[model samples]
Target: MRTMLVADDDPHIRSLLRQVLTGEGYQVLEAADGLEARERLEAAPVDLAILDVMMPGLDGLELCRIIRDTYDIPIILLTARQQLSDKEQGFLQGTDDYVTKPFEPEELLFRIKALFRRYDVPSLDKIRIGRVLIDRRNYEITAGDETLLLPVKEFELLAQLAQYPGRLFSRSELIERVWGLDYEGDDRTVDVHIKRLRQRFAEHDGSFRIRTIRGIGYKLEAGNA
Candidate 1:
């Protein structure tokens, strides 16, 4: 199920959106302000965010910018302003769409659906495992305060494994997925890349680990699990 974060200061607005969003089969996470929204995002992965522009303790536009820098989720800004300049600012802050206040719930729903369709490409998404973020959009990994870019093959390998944490993937299956089925190569190539990933993330061992299944293949395990 897709998860959505609703960050708005008004209780009535949050309750209304919750009802509408939940009725559509989406899991909803609520926050009274931008700070709580950020905390919710860090605690759990969300597919999209809906932020209210007039929120206290961190307005929507600033929070939108922070989310753009860290995550690859679509954002829709809700505001009372109808000025063209206001809409432009939201777009510049990385919002995918906007809905002015006194708007119909149906209109907001349509905008959300449109944004999801636009970002349906996997390359525009991100996979988060524990503290590690595999950002296919930028081909970067953010672990705590440090960000690193891996080689194409290495990044692909990790991203694939992280996509299904704790799911076993045989060497042949991995090669076909990451290296492509047409490429003829030794299965040990998988081992080499896995080794490099482990070495590269040795310091962040508490976050996640790549486990070798000995005779079978490998699987990624979240440290907390």
Candidate 2:
């Protein structure tokens, strides 16, 4: 089932959303505030997010920007405000759609379906190396029974390598693929993230290893499980 997050400060609103979303067969996750919503996202991935604009602590626009920078998912902003500036800000922050308050549940459901169709939702791109499972759909890695969520860049870097085990990738390629072709940062950024990934997985049983190709780049190889 596709998972959707509904974040709002009002309990009644959250409850109503949960009902409407669940009735449509989408699994619903809720957060009472913006910060809690962020925590929920980091711990578990959702296919789409519906965020209230007036949320306390890390409000919707800021949260939308943060999520957009990290995950490839659709976001819809819900607000009572009808100001054109508010709508513009939401779009600038990367919201896929904006829904005004007191909307018909049916209308919201129709919008949700349209977004799903547009984005081609429900695809899982996953790779397995020994006991490790890299799930691109959820932006999560599972090693045996433990699930780990890495920083967005770290996860993307690792996912790229895991997708083609034993295939070498140059720093330039990695930066282009993971950090985007427009990134203007130092190439050593890859080196720093790779180091962190190594440290993060050092304690796990040998299910996979990322090997540096000295002067060239890196590759992922299946290890003893």
Best lDDT goes to which candidate?
1
Per-residue lDDT of model 2, residues 1-225, tens digit only? 678999999899999999999888889999988999998776554779999999899899999998887566789999999999999999999999999998998999999999989888443498887888889988989988999999999998988887656555778778887999799897999999999999988976488888887777787777878
List residue ranges in candidate 2 displaced over 4 A.
121-225
**Residue pairs clashing, model 1:** none
TM-score of 2: 0.57
- Evaluate model 1: give its lDDT: 0.88
Model 2 — which ten-residue stretch has the worst lDDT?
Answer: 161-170
Q: 73-107 in candidate 1: lDDT tens per residue? A: 78999999999999999999999999999889999
Model 1 regions more than 4 Å off: 124-157, 160-196, 200-225
- The lDDT for every candidate, in the order shown, is 0.88, 0.86
